[model samples]
Target: LQQFLNASKTIDEFPNIPESSKSLLKKYLTKDVYKKLKDAKDANGFTLQQLISSGLANPDSSIGVYAGSTDSYKVFAPLLNQIISDYHQYDVNSKHTSSWDISSYNFEEFNSKHKGDYVLSTRVRIARNLSKFPLGTNITKEQRQQIENLAIQAFNSFEGELKGTYYPLGKLTEQEKKQLKEDHFLFKEGDRFLKACGCERDWPDARGIFINPSKTFLVWVNEEDQFRIISMQNGGDLKQVFERLAKAHEIINKVAQFSITENLGAITTCPTNLGTGMRASVHVKLPLLSSDEKIFKQIASKHHLDIRGIDGEHSESKGGIFDVSNKRRLGYSEAQLALDMYNGVNELIEVEKQLK
Candidate 1:
């Protein structure tokens, strides 16, 4: 209770919160709300402290909060629901249905069109958690290794294109680490946001990456979430990338159950990723379109797209290349979100062509 009071006091002082902080924790967490939820604890003994520790420690976190367990949703619905509705623009009363159907995603037009003029590479990835385990924030070291073992079994079960090797982070050689970082396939250690939330407790002990022979498909095990399945390749073949991801999603589901709900679609640690937990992106050159930040953002917003730097979020664009991706994750199907990026990128290219 005293800890809650101190944290609330700091939150009450607006000056203490950084001006650049846009997290929901900083936005919706008022003294009154904190006081109301202070003594509350979920059935699993997950406390409100565990939920907001990350946000409190990293004031600049965009979302600033996480779920220690799936039960955290029901236990902390008041704050979490508000954040979800605000970020995802989801109606709390409405149901969230997931659709991974790629049958109709046959983008014949895109297949024939030469997108190499502007598009460098296409990538699609989704965040998923195992239904039987607690999230990274609350998972024990033993549980984390167990998750890794399960992933190993799943990877071994793969036959055709999905067959791959698992490289544990703890065992990575200096050269291997450099190679992974250079290829942008590595998740670095010591993220302040992740650390504050207790996700970094076991460090790289049970963490690893599973990549197939082609290197186009990969999965990050025991990161912020249980799994971050991804598919990528050169050029702007969104359909191909998404199709691969969908197939992997299907295969993984056969090995383990993902934490999911009719109201949330895919349950994740962060509220912003609660629904689809998917991000379909392209690192493309949009020199003219991106020159004017305001116009670039306006056009992106019109198509429900988000623009990020070439090195990913918070980084700067390089050599006229920018990361363009779907902004909406909730209240939409997996295929719908992929289509949103496909159509949105096409629109962006058109706008770019018209620009000086």
Candidate 2:
């Protein structure tokens, strides 16, 4: 049924991007990866089905390609551009000097203060992977357990406001699981798309949530990505959230090693999340922007933003609220990512007021 729905039912076997779908790769300009494609003998570890399906669904996607493993570098290098762009944007060729800092940004003076009933809430989520481990798509069951074990050690090490409890999905009741998901506090079951790619196997195997005592900061282990570190609040206090995440990131890394590239910064299952792996977002009420989607989209594009429904990723908006977040993550610092959205949301709110 899933294949029938994806138009992949006619083909039997592991999904590959296929010859016809290679055209999807032409949109982005990549350096090292493309040069190697001419001499490369095989698809490395990637299946054609895994490469193009997501983009086939949304061609306008900024980064259309994916790598199932570190070997994916041999399979697809175009994503290497994520690192190049990051280095070029920041002029940092070494990870030693490059840094992730939220100290320079203050959301209070700008967007958060003027939120004025227009802003609902702000969130910052960072996607990270355990070093030397295959991405979620290609990780073994034991590897998943290993990640869970590492996470338990790390979460236990958290101190002060960051300390929390680990709730393994395999132990949770159906009601508890459903509630976490509905609250957007936990990830849903693996999607059919991910299942096809071998990302979701042995359901409820090692998946779980770790929320701090305050519940304002949490991490999702073995979800869409290995680790989705999140800090959020009821209103737009982005400074507090960013600072908390920065401290938590510092503490978590002591126990968990994230896949980091000297040039790429931090590597993730998704190419777009390469550098920062951070998606700082705001749930905003945009009645005026909703009324003029074309203009709204143009403004969002100008601000380098991606807009989603209030319910998130493919769900429809309720009461004119949308999730707007930074679209370019591969080439900037974490602070810059948040800053872009802070300034952009301010611009959006200004437009919303004028429309009234």
Candidate 3:
């Protein structure tokens, strides 16, 4: 069973294996093993199907198929066990690096039906640090290796769990099967499969990639292209990655600000900052902070700048307060616009102090 599960890494590799089994096998095997299994052939010189039918139906075995007299369970259990074991191993090895904490890893599991088969799908999150590289620079050998390692590890862990389960028989009840059918797990002519990570979207055939249960905030990595999709849920990491990429690509920075009023006629309670709102923030490329305390306070008082600490006020109520990003205005670069916002505020405050 272990060998069978490990034989195919991709869905296309094992056509004879039920979709359910393929999904489970994917969950258990390491990326390396999964790739090998994907490329492996059955022992009998026949396909995986022929080998399974010959030996799986022994009566004394604990693993038996409920639907039919097949020994499907015996063929699948070892793969599942291997997958579970691999997960634990990863969990243990991953703990040593503060950067690779499980807290940064997010996952979701669900089931999908294709044709007459049921498939279990999962999404996992991974944290990658990219601050070391400057924008637009070619990836160094070290960086390339790091990215490859992450991709291989992720795929292996997924493959392990996938190999463990018997094909197409996820612990679903008869009622659940009926419900799933009603919910359209069965493949449709126009069904599409779409996956997005970070800012990239994959709509190969828009009609072919339908969302079974749509997921918004998850990371997906595709080894074929060596690209990833990062959801908004992990904005901190996403932002860092974006910044790094921008530097490497020589992309200019841009800034945009939100205001309470769109026009001068709009009335606001915050008298001092009525025109601009209580917040006056700029996204700067230099990564500078207000160092002169006296100047900072004077400006705050004059403009009614509610200088917020790292934990912004919106966080307490909305949860992801810090995730809100500055708007991007075209034409003007980010660094130039940020300088204008901060310097303009400082200039206004200085003028106000002089008049007083």
Q: Judged by TM-score, which candidate is best?
A: 1
lDDT of 2 at 142: 91
**Candidate with more favorable, higher TM-score: 2 or 3:** 2
lDDT of model 3 at residue 220?
Answer: 22
Q: Quote model 2's TM-score.
A: 0.81
lDDT of 3 by residue, 76-192 (tens): 324423432342222211211111112222211101111211111111211122222210012233443454344333323332112111112224455754664343232211111
TM-score of each: 0.92, 0.81, 0.17
Clashes of each: 0, 7, 53
lDDT of 2 at 282: 85
lDDT of 2: 0.71
Q: Provide the lDDT at 303 for model 2.
A: 85
Model 2: residues >4 Å from true position, as ranges?
1-65, 78-98, 109-112
Clashing residue pairs, backbone N/CA/C < 3 A, model 2: 15-49, 16-47, 16-48, 16-49, 17-48, 17-49, 86-331
| Cα lDDT of model 2 by residue, 130-221, tens digit | 76687776677899999999999998788888888999988999999888777778776856545555566677899889987667998999
RMSD of each: 3.3, 5.3, 26.8
